[model samples]
Target: MIIKTVKSLSQALLLVALTLVLHSCSNPDEGSAIETVVYPSDVIPFMDQWKILLGDGTHTDEVEDYEAPNFFYVANDGEADWVVYKTPNAGVTSRTSSNTRTELGQIEHWTPETGGKLTGTLKVKHVSTSGDARAAASYSVVVGQIHSNEGNENEPLKIFYKKFPGHSKGSVFWNYEINTEGENAKRWDYSTAVWGHDMSVVGSSPKTYPEEPEDGIELGEEFSYEINVYNGIMYLTFMSAEHDTVKFTKNLLQSEFTSKAAIPKQILTLYVSLGRDGIERKNAYAGEIQYFKQGAYNQTNGKDPEDNMVWSTGSAIYDGDIAKQYANGSYTEVWFKEATVGPGTAPN
Candidate 1:
C-alpha cells in the first residue's frame, strides 16, 4: 500500500521533531543571561609608593599643607576666595547624606590624630564670586595608604559588635550581577557604594569572570570577581562576562567611580596607598582615597540623583587629554584627543 504510506509519514515526522526539541529546552523567557563589567585592579602595587613628607613630594605653597595620613591634595577654584578646613579623626564619624560632592573632589574619611598614621589638612581658596564663576577650575593632590572598610548604605558591614571586637559573622554583601541575552533575561543590579578601609594587599579581586567557555556557546567571553575579608573588613564583587565587558585604564579615585559628570580633562592623578600592616595600622584606617569618574550630578531613576556638593583635590592640573595617571591617588582624569565614546564605550 504505497510502501505502507511512506512508512507512516516517516514515523510522523520523527515524532514532531522530538516534541519541538523538548519544548525549547524547557522554556527560557527572560533576557537569557549574560553581562559583566567591573574594575579596580590594574596591579598598582607601588612605585615610589607615594612618599612626599613635604614639597619635593611635589607641588607647593609650603607644600600645600599635607599632614600625611598617607598623602594627596589637589586644589584650584580660581576667581579667589576662602574657608577650608577638613579635619576629622579623634572620633566623630558623620557623612552619610547618601552621596554628593565634587567641585574638585576629595575629603574621604578624614580621620587622623596621632594614630600611628595621622594627618589631615585642606584649605583651598574661593568662597565668593559663586565659588569662582563656576565654569571650571583645577585640583590635584595624590596621596596613598590603602586598606578599606566603612559600612552603612544598607549595612556595609554593620559594626557595633560590642564596639568592634574583631567583629565577624561570616561577612557577606559584595553582591554583583549583570545580565542580557536573547529572550529577556535582564538583571543588572549593582550600586551600593560606600565601604572604605581594609588593607593588607588583597584589594585586587578576581577569581573567575575572564573567559572563553567554548562548546555550550560561551565562546563569547567570561569574567567574575569577588574579594571578601572579614574582621579587617573588605568586600568587593565584579562579575562581568558580557553587558559591556568593562575596561578603564586610569581613574584616580573618586570613590572608585559611580559617574554622572566630574571628569573634564587633565593629566589624571593618583597617589593611593593602603597597607599599614594589621588593622590598617593605628585605627582610623589611613587616609587619601580619591576618584571622580565624571561630574555634574542630577538623575534619579537612571542613577546619580544629585548632591555633588563641591568636593576638593589640591590645586588640580592635567591638560593631557583623556587624562591617565595612576598610583598617585587612583582616579579623576580627562584629556580626550579623540575616541569620545565607543571603543566599547562606558567611562562616563
Candidate 2:
C-alpha cells in the first residue's frame, strides 16, 4: 500500500513539472512582444491607385503592398484608423523638389479639357515650429496639389496649411504656380486665401509672427476639399464644420494674371524677396497634362532664411535623424481619413 501511494505521488509531481515547462515555453515575453504594424493601404483602400515617394528617398510605384516605417503608416486618431503621411524637415530630397515628402502621385494624368476630380478629408496634425516666422513657407505644409508632368514641370495648384508657433490657429490657402512661357527660372506662385490670410501675409521681421487670422483652422480640426476640373474650369470647395463653407472657380484655360499690372498686392509683397515678378502664360495651363498629389509635402527646410526668406525656413533637422526631429517638433504629419480620385463629373 505504501509503494502504491508513493508511485501515485511521483506521477502527480511529474505531470505538474511537465505542465510548468510547457507553459513557460508557450508564453511570450510581454516586454519583447512585437506589434503588428498597420500599412497605409490597410487604412485607405484607394492607395492601390497611386504611387508614393517617402521622405527617405524611397519610391514605390506599386503601393498596394508597400509600407515604409517612420514615413507612411496607419495611425489611430481617437475615433478611427487614419492614413498618416509624415516627413521630416530635412531628408533625402526628391529629384525635382528640394524639400522632403511622403506624398502620393496619381498614376493617371489628364488634361484640363478632359478634366479630373480629386477629393480629400483630412486633419493637419503637426507642422514644424522652429523655422523663421517671417518666411512665407515657414511652418507650412502642402497637403494637396496639381503638378504638370510636361514642359517646365510647374505646379498649377498647391493647397497649403501654415501656423506660427504659439498660435492657436493656422491659415489654409492655395497657390497657383504660373507655367512660365519662356524661362522656368523666372516663375512665381500666386496665392489665394481659403480660410484665413493668404500666403502673402508675413511678419514684419524674421522672429515676428503676423496677427493670428480670426477665421482659421486649429490643429487636428477636420476639413474637406474638392478639386473638380470640369471642361477646363477648375472649381474648388472647402468645408469645415466650424467655419462657413467656401467655393471658388477659376478658368484654367485662360490666364488671369497675364501682365504685371494684373498682379495683386499680395503677390507683390510675397514675391518681392525672391524677385519672382514674372507673369503667367497667356493661355494658363492649357493643353498641359496635369496630375494630382496628396500627402505631407514638407515646405519647411534647413536652408538659410537670408537666401530667400519666403522659401527658406531654417528648421532644425538634427542631421536627418527622424527620431530627433520628432522629439524637437521638426516634422510634418498629416492624417487623411477619406479620399477619392476619379474622372471629373459634369457639373449640375
In order, candidate lDDTs are: 0.20, 0.89
- Residue 284 of model 2: what lDDT? 90
Winning model by lDDT: 2
In model 1, which runs have C-alpha deviations exceeding 4 angstroms?
1-9, 16-18, 25-33, 36-138, 141-348
Expressed as tens digits, the lDDT of each residue in 263-319 for candidate 2 is 878777777557888888899999999999999999999999888868888888898
What TM-score does candidate 2 get on C-alpha atoms? 0.89
User: Mind giving the per-residue lDDT tens digits that candidate 1 earns over 77-196?
Assistant: 353221121111111112432111121122232211111111111121111111111111111111111222231111111110000111121111121111111221221212221121
Best by TM-score: 2
Which stretches of model 2 miss by more than 4 angstroms? 1-37
For model 1, how many clashes?
A: 85
